[model samples]
Structures are given as structure tokens and as C-alpha cells.
Target: MVEEVERRKKEILKAIIHEHIFTAEPVGSRTLAKSYELGVSSATIRNEMSDLEELGYLEQPYTSAGRIPSDKAYRFYVDTLINDRENLNLELIKLLNNFNYERQGIQQIMSNMAKMLSSVTRYTSVVSEPQMKKSRIKQIQLIPVEGKRILIVLITNTGIVHNKIVKLKQDLNPRQLGYLNEYLFNNLKDKRIKGINNLVLQELEKRLIKRLDLSQEIIELVYKGLEMVSKEDDFKIYLGGTSYILEQPEFNDLDNLKKVLNILDHEEMLKDLLVTIPNKELEVMIGHENKIEEMKKCSLVFASYTVGDMASGKIGVIGPTRMEYSRVIASVNTVAELMGKIISELSG
Candidate 1:
């Protein structure tokens, strides 16, 4: 008898969640009794909903009204009810498999991934570049562009290329520049980009200045180029389907919409938020689970993707707390895994 009651409660909760996901409306007992084959009367379903609400799985937004699944209910559904082996959309899988990572760069790939996710999930998508702190330098070249300017080209193990222009106070001849390039390549080779900080640059400058009898101006130019390459902003973010958020009922309020727009505008904050999640596993932050104040009313589904062997990045979708968790979770996991595989292949 106890087992039967538990089964009935699960059925009712699943039906409510499914209805709420599509309609974005509160689910009533009558709706469940009519739509779902729960083998119970409206009164019995109402009593079960009351019990579920009292137990914290469902919440009534108003008096004498229908109920909506709370964060707890969503969590229960994701953990216990969702099928882990849900197949990826076949069309999306074909698109992913056909992607040409050789011709298209990583940035383009990330942008397309974000766009694909948004289009499929109908939610805002955010994809970040691989963190450079863990990526080792594969090559460094200093090419003289013109008088008093040089182009510093850096390639990382993850196949990311960074180029910067540095102005030198005094110009150095091609021979001197060649020696400097070789020195930089030898010093930075195999060193993590983030590990090359100002201190390291200063040390390199001091050594080059003393050993080669180079002018302080030329050494400072090299240091400046290295500094630009190692900055935290080396990692970039790409966003897609931002307009989709406006379609959700939760963002119908002007103030709520504005808050989300503001949060999206600040790319650094979004990058920080994605990285601070200690776990690289697929994670769902519902409602108040988000630390950012603007996201308290929203839900975030995110997962990490690897580049090469060491470097990794994050990809996620943001929508109202009433999001379809099963679909969002499956979509995020599939995209993240495909992205990691493509990146690994390209980097190799």
C-alpha cells in the first residue's frame, strides 16, 4: 500500500512537471486527473498535491490555486526520474559530426556550438574559450612589422593563436630581433601561458639586456608583448540566442528582463561564474542555487569541455527556473562532449 502511494505521487509530480514545462502555467488537480492516467479521482490527486506541497516538492503561488514544481521537485526529477541514456537529436548529431574543425578555427567552432545549442534548446547559450593557464606554449615568434613595431605571435598547445603588436621605443635590426625571437621561443616553450607573469617577464628582460647588451627599450618591448599574451583576458566568451530569454514568461516583467540583460553584458562576470563551479561534471543551478543575485530567479545548466589534454572550457544554457531540465541536461551534455572531442582532435 505504501509502495503504491509512492508510485502514485511520482506519477502526479511527473505529470505536473511535464505540463508546467510546456505551458509555463500552474498545474491543477483537474488538469492532472483529465490528462494523466493516474487511476485516481480529482480529490485524491488534490490531496496528494497538498501532501507534496507540504513536503516542499511543490509550491502554490496563490491561495486556492494550482501548484508549480519547486526547485526540490526539479532536483528529484533530474536525479531519480530522468533517463540518463536519452539519445541526442539525430540531426544535431549529424551536424556535429560533419563539422570541419580543420578549416574552421576554435573560435568559430565555439560560436557555432553556442548558436547550435541556443537554436536546439531555445535558450540563451554561453561558451567560453579554453583556459590558457593550463595550456603550454608551443611556439613564439617576433616578426618585425615596420619601424618601431613588432608583431608577437604565440601558439599554444591547445592550438590557440594569440597575436599582439608592441611598439618599441627604439628599433632593433633584423639580426638583433632574430636573437630576441630565439631567446623568447626557448624560454617560453613548454611554459604555461599564465605562468609567464610580469615577474617572469622582468627576469627575462634583465637576462636579455645583460647577455645581449640590448637597449632597455628593446627588452621592454619584448616584455610588453609577453605581458599581453599572458593576461587573464586571453580567454574569451561567445553568446547566442540571447533574444530567446524574452520569450519566456518569467522575463515578461521589464525589470526582470533588464537584470538578465545586464548580467549578460558583463562577459567577465559570466566567465568567473562558470569557472567557479568546482565540479566539471554536468551541473544544474536552479533558482536560488545561483550565487549571482541577477540569476537567483533563473536556472543554469552547464558542463565543461576539454581542449587538447590539459586545457578546458565551459558551455551552458540559461533559462527560467521552469526550464525543461531533461531536455536541457541532455543537450548540454551532448554538446560539451562533442566539443571536447573536436577540440582534442584539432589540437593534436
Candidate 2:
């Protein structure tokens, strides 16, 4: 009997959530009891809904006749109700296939994916180039600019390049820098440069020190500069539909709008938000489930796009907590996967 009551309550809750998502309005117990055919009276559904409200699953605003799903309820609905393994709709699959993305670069793919998501979900979308740490070195070009500075150009598999100057204590002539460039190209080109250490630097140091008067300090400086270059490569976040949030009822408060924009301005924080879960698969953060205080009023769904073994990136959508989880999750996952495939094809 307890199990039966629990199952019926779940059904009623799901119906309410579904209806609310569709209408963006509060759901009345009588409506669910009558239209959803819960096989129960309005009185009984009202009792159950009152209990759900008490349990933090539903909220009744201003003594209203209808109820809406609370953050906790949305969390429960998303976690237990969603079946991610289910194949996407055939129309959705066909739409994804029609993108003509085979030869497109990762940037265009991400931009297209964002636009697609916004069009379908009526929400803002942001796509980040795969995070830099997960990417491998595709090529390194050391260009001699002056006697003391060399422009170090690092290319990753994600079609992005990072350039920095390595300041040397000693002036290195073009010929010497040319030999150094050759050494870098021969040994380090196409190598994953993230795990470089003292021993690796020592080996290169021994070889180069004998050939030139370059100090260990200068060699280590170049190596450290490259490390900073790699971390900076993690993301170039492009945001769209930011104005859409302002149009939502939840963000009508000017202060909340300012807070949300302030949070988005911190790129590293956004990276942390996207990458903290550490899953290559799609993940959803709804309402209060987000650790950031400003984000508590919204929901975020994103996925990490891998670029070979060298790097991974993120693509995600941000909207009010009332977002359609199934649709957003599916679309975001599709975009991330397509972006990854495009990146791989580009580097290959």
C-alpha cells in the first residue's frame, strides 16, 4: 500500500512538472486530476500536492490555486525521470545530420551549434573551444623576432594557436635561434608538451648548452612560458542570447541581472563550472544544484568535447531553471560531439 501510494505520488508530480514545463504556468490539482486522468479525485490530488509542497517539491505563490515545481522537484524530476540512453527523435537526428559540418572548422561548428540550440530551446548558448590541457601539441613554430626575444607559436589540435615571447638573458643570433628552432621541431613537434619536466628540460638543456651559451635559466624560461601558453588555450568562450535572460521573468530584477553577467565575465569560473564534473558525457546543473550563488536561479547543461587525446572543450546552454531538460541536454550533447569530430578531422 505504501509503495502504491508512493508510485501514484510520483506520477502526479511528473504530470505537474510536464504541464508546467509546457505552459510555463502553475498547475492546479484539479487540472491534473481531471485532464491527466490520475484516476484520483481532485481532493486526493490536492492532498498529495500539499504534501509535495511541504516536502520542498512544489511551491504555491501568493496563496494561489495552482502549484509549481520547486528547484528540488525539478532536480528530482531531471535525475530520476530522464532516460538519456533513449535515442533522439528521428527529426532531431535528421536535423543534426543536415548541418554540413564535415569540412567546417571547430569555431564555425560551435557557432552553428549555439545558434541551433538557441533556436530550438529559446535560450542563450555558449560554446568554448576544448580546454587546453586535454589537447596535444600539433606544431610549434619558434620565430626569431629580435636578439633576445623569440615568438613561440604553439598550435593545438583544436585549430587554435598560442603565441608568446621568450625573453632570453643572452642575445641569440638568427642562426643560433634557427638551430634551436630545428631542435624544437625535430624533438618536440607533435609531442604533448604538458608533462614537460626538469629531466626533459635537462636533456634538451644538455644538448643545447653544448652547442650554444644559452643558460639553463633561459631554457627554463621558454619552457615555463610555453606552460602558461597551454593553460590559456583552454577556452575561448563565445556567448549568444545573453539578452534572452533579461526577457525572462525570473531575471526582471536589475541586481540579479548584474550578478549573472558578472559571473559570466569570469572565464576561469565558467570553465570550472563546465569542467568540474569531469565527464565526457552531457551533464545538467539545475537551479540550486549549481555551486555558484548567482547561478542558483538558473540551470546549465553542458558537455566536454574531446580533441583527440590532446585536449577537451565545453559547449553548454544557460537558461532559467524552468528549461526543458531533455531537449537541452540532447541538443547540447549533439553539438559537443559534432564539435569534437570536426576538431579531430581538422587536426588529422
Candidate 3:
């Protein structure tokens, strides 16, 4: 249950959290009274802080006079205080524009994007490659090359084109190639990647071998071509600034630091860490909210980028619990939007 705070207490809580995030130190009531215009005396602010501590919103660290925000407070702040559509970061726009979308392949684009996100946010950034499994095959064409080699061209709805070259026992003429192209497209058009399976291949081969008088080598190569296009290499995580997380004071302890570093070392673990939420909303996982044991002290922010209305992949930021939610949120949202736009344009 979310506990409600009065307007005055809300102001005080906000002031303390903002101060704590800035200094990475437990916030003292005097600092809030002097720095923020809470319209309350230091004594009143101290009393409210005491109440907040009792309510599990704040905690005193090791007999320190000042108090720091608890995970609960961070969750509440993310839920209520931070605005998702905050003002744009102009520097981010300029940096994104620097990407040479026309020259770079998909791998380079995703790598550069990860580096850019980490640079702007000053936190570790993780990105996944664009997923093609959900994309429907728009067309497939077979073209004969030198000797008995045939090149397979596979086009999908997301603008991704895959090319595979296979050698056949017999060379195909123009008429034969034309017939095969039409046959493949008519059967496979608008079919999702999952639709291409062993059963589908068997059905295609049974018809093609009989109709075209195809050699056994040709039939096997045809199945291989289809398999190559439908194969998925999705959810490949790209990491930028793996060492940035080490800069946080929270990970200063050697034991704790080692654990966190191990978490970053595994791509599969990082994949589990950055889960994108539905409805295109920014997902923020505060300290202790994360399921990973080593990530309990960290905060993660994820934003999904779309390709033709489907969530293709995610862009994420990893930082200490003292993360600047407002700034990170803005950067992630802006970059995700730009990536989606570039991908759509590239596909065309």
C-alpha cells in the first residue's frame, strides 16, 4: 500500500531526497532548511524527518545525525516526483544527430548508440540488437551465381534484408530461377519467422521436388536457405561503460564491488536485468526492486524502441541507487525515440 503524505511532509521529503542525491551523503534538516524554501523551521523539518524514518521512508546511516532516503522513498519519488516527459536535453539531440545512420550497419549502429547513452548519462548503458523473429517475410528471391552457386535474398517487413549463398549440384537457368522465386514468395510471404519450421520445409520440398524435377542437392540447399533467413539472433546485449558503475560510492566496498562487476560481466544476466515495460512507458527499477542479487544496490531504467509498432529491443541505464532519475529518464526516452525513427527510415 502506498502511504499518503500531507503537502508539508511531501515538500520536506522531496527536499531531503534531492539533497541526498546531490551530495551522496545523509541529508540533515539544517541543510534542507537553509537550501530549500520549505517554509518550515529546522525543528519542524527534523520532526518530519523523524516521522519519515519511522514510516520507513528514510534511514539514519551508522549513527549519523543526517538521514538518507530508503528504497521506499526512492520508489515513491520515482512514482510521483519525477516527470516522464521532462524538458529535452539539447546536447542529447545534437549527439544523436551525429550518428551516421546511412553508413553504419546494424551492429555498428547499436554499438554507437550504447556508447552514446553511457556517455550522456554517465552510467553503464546496455542495448539489445533489433529482433527480426517477429518480422514477417515480405519476399524471397533466388538468383543464380557463377557455377552451381545460388544466392538467396530474404526481405522482411522491418526493412532487414538477409543474403545467403549456397552451391547446388545443377545450375539453374533464368526460367527456373523465376519459377522458384515466385514459388517461395507465394508460399512464404507475410509468414513470421516462427512459421518457417521443419514441417514447413518438408511441405515445400515435397511440392518443389515433384514440380521442378529438382535434384536432392537443390532441395536440401533450399531448406538451408529458408532456415538461414528465419534464424533469430535476438536479445544480444551490448554494453557501454561497464566500469562506470564502479565510480558510484555505493560500490566502494571491495566485496560488494566485486559482486557488482561480476553481474556486469555476464551478458545473459544483464539481459535479465533490463526488462522493458509495456505500453511504451519508461520502466524504473529502484534498489531492492531488482530480482538479481548483485543488482539490489543499483537502479535501472529501461525504454523500449519500436519497429513498425512492435517492441524490437530495449535501451537501459545502470547506476547506483543515488541516480538522477529525472536526467536519466529524459536521456533514455529521447534516445529510444530517435533509434526507433532511424530504424523505420532505414528499413524503408
Where does candidate 3 stray beyond 4 Å? 1-5, 97-99, 138-186, 194-202, 209-233, 275-279
lDDT per residue, candidate 2, 1-348, as tens digits?
A: 999999988999999998988777889987897779788889999999988989999998667889999999988987898775454545557667787876776677777777776666678887887656656677877776766787888877667777888877777777877887788778776666566555876787778878876777777777777767777445677776767787677787788787788767787777666655546577788888888888888898888777765336777889888877877787777767777777788778
TM-score of 2: 0.89
> What is the Å distance of residue 80 in model 3 from its true position?
0.9
Scored by TM-score, the top model is 1
Q: Please provide, for model 3 over 181-222, each residue's C-alpha lDDT reduced to its tens digit, 9 standing for 90 to 100.
A: 899899989888766789988998889888896687888897
Backbone Cα, N, C clashes tallied per candidate? 0, 9, 0
RMSD of 2: 2.7
Which segments of model 1 are wrong by more than 4 Å? 1-3, 145-149, 194-203, 216-221
Each prediction's Cα lDDT score? Answer: 0.85, 0.77, 0.81
Q: What is the lDDT, from 0 to 100, of the residue 338 in candidate 3? A: 80
Clashing residue pairs, backbone N/CA/C < 3 A, model 1: none
Q: What is the lDDT of residue 118 in candidate 3?
A: 93
Instruction: Quote the positional error of residue 277 for candidate 2 in Å.
Output: 3.8
RMSD of each: 2.4, 2.7, 4.3
